[model samples]
Target chain A: MSAEETVSQPNPIEQFELHRIFPLEINGIETSFTNASLFMLLAALGVVALMVLATSRQAIVPGRIQSLAEMLYEFVANMVRQTAGKEGMKFFPFVFSLFSFILIANLIGLVPYTYSVTSQIVVTFAFAALVLTLVVVYGVYRNGLGFLKLFVPHGVPLPVLVVLVPIEIISFLSRPISLSVRLFANILAGHITLAVFGGFVVLLLASNGWSFLAPVPLLAIVALYALELLVACLQAFVFSVLTCVYLNDAIHPGH
Target chain B: MKMTIISPAFAAESEQETHETVGATGGEAHHEGGFPPFQQENFAPQIVWLIGIFGILYLLMSRVALPRVGGILENRETKIASDLEASREMQAKAQAAARANEENIRLRREEAQAIGRDAQQKIANEAAAQRTRAETEAAEKIRAAEARISAAKTQALGNVEQIAIDAAASIIEKLSGAGVDKDRLVAEYRNVKSS
Candidate 1:
């Protein structure tokens, strides 16, 4: 439960709480715009604005913004090219957008007092589901029933095949769950750990006897913050690299 | 004795439990018992915004940004290619011009050398002609000078011969009382001059 603070202790989960900026509904659907949604929008805008401003001048000699944008473009482009093959370049836009959105969303969440969109299960799951959907759609579209051949491991004996096939199917089914969880859990855990450590400082300082120990928790929070920053970027990269791998599966779908 | 001590501790524990439960219940009632993201109410807007913004980002990337970057990169490639080609052409032109310049200098040098040789030959010919004309004129002057001196000596000798003949005739008339012919004496002086 988020925002579950009690009288006795500071609940770290409260940081994940959502409050609607404007309570909204339509056709009997409650569509309240949330802090989570706000940050998601900010992250998207930040990515778009970066790309637009970088290429706005289109100078032969790139400036800092252009260099960053170009580097990011080539980074994702090369990732798809290497993992998914040249044909995979068709999905470069999708991969770039996903990578940018997740990376920026993760970074922004690291800022104090800002919401972390990728930390939300719904957001990460939505992204995972999108990747899974594309993989299934393209895999089947390109390879037809041959795509199912991916499950049947080659050179395995008939008796051993029974065990391997189900494992492969289960593993395939688990991709989205793992994809979403990896990002969601990493961010959720990092932020919560940071909050838990930070709460100890308040708890220590508030207690007359433990005032001297407040600095200890405060120092721990500092160390955790740096670690959290690394986790933020690492989780984003992990998510992107997995996306490319899944995409490669879609493209090949044979082995 | 155990009951007396345990009762207070039990009462204190129950009271704390009551307070904690009340707070938990109160908080649960307020936000409800779930993760905010899992709450059914928030999903629609999040999904909606996610779709909308992701759509915009995708369009911006595929339609505008990526193509623009590609165009710029391709433009740079062509620019480099054309620049290299132009430089190569210029180099070729420079090489050709240098060759032509060297050829022209060679031609001019050959022409100047030919003119120098011709002028040397012409001066030699003119000097030889002037030397031959001067030599012929000097020999003619020598021959005329020699003829003139010989004629003058002959005339002086004739005058002296007449004077001798006259002197001899006067002596012969005065001393020998005989005068030989002047013509004969002149003839005898001419023979003696010949011998």
Candidate 2:
């Protein structure tokens, strides 16, 4: 409140952190339900409920909600089929659910009062770990030890295996890290950009002298929000599609 | 094998970029906390949670959502096939009806021709009988007219004979010698007429 305390530049990364509600402590550990987790859970449930309600009363000629439901189904189905072929159908439900969950989470975060779960490393890592687990387990199950052949390069000099194998294993293990980072970074960056633009508009308006110029930042924020909506859906789709591709590699390990 | 090796190499290059970004961000958070900050819940609980979600999702999808969708698709296919079969049956029935109708027309045409032939034969027979009857009746009428002319001719001949005899007697009385010969002349005329 002091006159000497000037307005400082906002830290975009800290702005993205989920603020703890009730600030509860359990055995000296932070056990509070954060806003981000709450919204993420809500988004997941919302997606499930939407799909159920949309498809429950499936008419011979689909109504609008049913058509939308079918569209989402067909979209994910075709993506899987394209990426993994007939083998993909076995993974259809998982991929479709993943796509819907991420899509809904992203869209829900765009709401003013909601937090984006994908912006959090923990949440993204959870999804990435699931994908990586399936890839490893299913790969070995389907192909057995032959799955190890995936690390060995074909038509290469045998001497090069020394250099290639370790690099390949490290790369394989890094799948979850890269997957998680891609989604988390995109969502986090987009939100931060929007927040910064919004802060500019607020600061401009508060200045009063630059009230006329406030519309510029406000317009930029609106445009960026729209862009963010697109990016949100795109990132979800990219994540799901990449998971399918990885599953394809697991099912048929070599080529 | 070649793709597998190449793919991971490509992925690693991208991973390197991500690590660099993470490193940059991690440095900024160093004052608040150390690099690779530990969570309140360790990896074990997080793994359990992940596994739990995966299991539930797997069950929901495999048991519930998949079957519902598959059932809908199967029902649609069955309905379409049944509809198609029903239409095919209708088409076959229509074709059979059309063929029966053509057969009926063919039979009626043959029957009509037979009836027409019978009518013509009946008319020909009646016409032949009428012609024969008329010929016979005309022949009888001609024979009766011939008989009536013959009778009239005979009666006229007898009257002429009597007139001739009377004329001959009168001529004989005009002369004594002729009178004596008139009886003989009339007798000669009667003999000649009889002959």
Candidate 3:
């Protein structure tokens, strides 16, 4: 390896994980509270507090906070009702909480020194698994063994069953994996890009000449940050809507 | 099918390159690992956390949020229905009041027409009575004038007869005086008559 190349390259992943806030080890199992985890927990609590405070009064003519709260409430509520029907309303609070939590986590990450919990696959996977579990348990509870029929498309030839069933099951199982990876990858890539651009600015300025070229990357980073904000909102919405759709399938399994 | 073969080869090469990059950095630090730290390796805690949050959320939605919204909508429906009933009642009352007013106006007009007819009859009777009284007074005055004229005509005829008789007697008396010697005159008259 060339000396200049070695000097220029930095470990991006290490830099991303440097701010580990808590360290704990117990028995053979060690669980540490990461800065990312801390921020996510705080964001979740903040969302809850804001929702509660905004809705506690229940004014006929809503104030700004109350209006915001109601808009979000109705947004998720309508999504559930439209996708899942009357039975889906029962899932409104869960879907709403999930949406709010993920939304806040994504937005809070944009702040300096705040870690984005959603960038981690473990976090996203957990969210996806919970949704999947709900779909399964609820589907079986509602439809009994008939819930397995979800894997079998109707009106297909019997001879196709052998090929189709396994493919359907694999596709079903892949849902959580894809759902988690989509969110994690998007957030992780955005943050890494921002960091690299920032590092470029630093390196250019430190080199003392040709520093003016740094503005181009800086401008790009700014634009990317704005785009990330939009993505964050979109991803949160997509996640919540998909959850609603999955629950809808569980409630009414045909089509 | 042929393209698929090339795609997998390209993907494998990309994966290998990524691993090599990771390995090259932090050489001894990377080598010292049996597994990455539990923080890095274990996905269990996150799964547990997400499941727990979702479970709590589901319970809250089923128990709390939905019921409140349903109640609000139901209450609004009841309120609107009651308000409509009240307005209908007010409308009915107003219609009844208007009907009563119309009936009163009709009765009043009939009463006024009856009173006008009675007044007109009384005025016509008074005029007829006045005309009859005037005719009676005129006839009485004519009768009294005729009686006075007949009495005056009778009196004038009696006066005219007395005057004529007096004048005739006086002429006869004058002629007799002129001839004082009546007996002598009578002898003479007898003579003359014989002649």
Please provide TM-scores, in order, for all candidate models, with all chains considered together.
0.70, 0.69, 0.66
Model 2 lDDT tens row, A95-202: 987888789888987887566767767778888988999999999999999888878867668789899989989988888998988887778767666665565665
Q: Model 2: number of clashes? A: 0
Model 1 spans > 4 angstroms off:
A1-9, A154-160, A209-216, B1-32, B37-41, B95-195
Poorest 10 consecutive residues by lDDT, candidate 2 chain A: A1-10
Per-residue lDDT tens digits for candidate 1, residues B96-117, read: 9999999999999999999999
Listed per prediction, chain B TM-scores read: 0.46, 0.53, 0.48
Range of the 10 consecutive residues with the lowest summed lDDT in candidate 2 chain B: B1-10
lDDT of 3 by residue, A1-255 (tens): 001212244222332352335665557544555555566666766675556655566555567876676677778778889988998877777788788888888888777567777877778887888899999999999999888888888888988988998998998899988787778767766765666566566556666677878788789889988998998899898888889988987888765
Model 2 TM-score on a 0 to 1 scale: 0.69
**What RMSD value applies to candidate 1?**
9.2
Candidate 3 lDDT tens digits, B19-113: 22122112112212211212354444444444555455445544654454444435556777888999999999999999999999999999999
lDDT of 2 at A25: 56
| Candidate 2 deviant stretches above 4 angstroms | A1-11, A22-32, A58-61, A152-171, B1-58, B109-195
Clashing pairs in 1: A3-A14
Indicate whether candidate 2 or candidate 3 has the larger DockQ.
3
What clash pairs does model 2 have?
A: none
Q: Put down candidate 1 lDDT per residue, A1-255, tens digits, no spaces.
A: 124444346655567777789888889776778888789889988998888867899987788888788888888888888887898899888888888889899888888788888877778888999999999999999999888878897788999989999999999999999898788778877776676666667667788897899899789878888888888778877888888888888888765
Overall lDDT per candidate, in order of appearance: 0.78, 0.69, 0.67
Candidates 1 and 3 compared by lDDT, better number: 1
| Residue A142 CA displacement from its true place in model 2, Å | 1.8
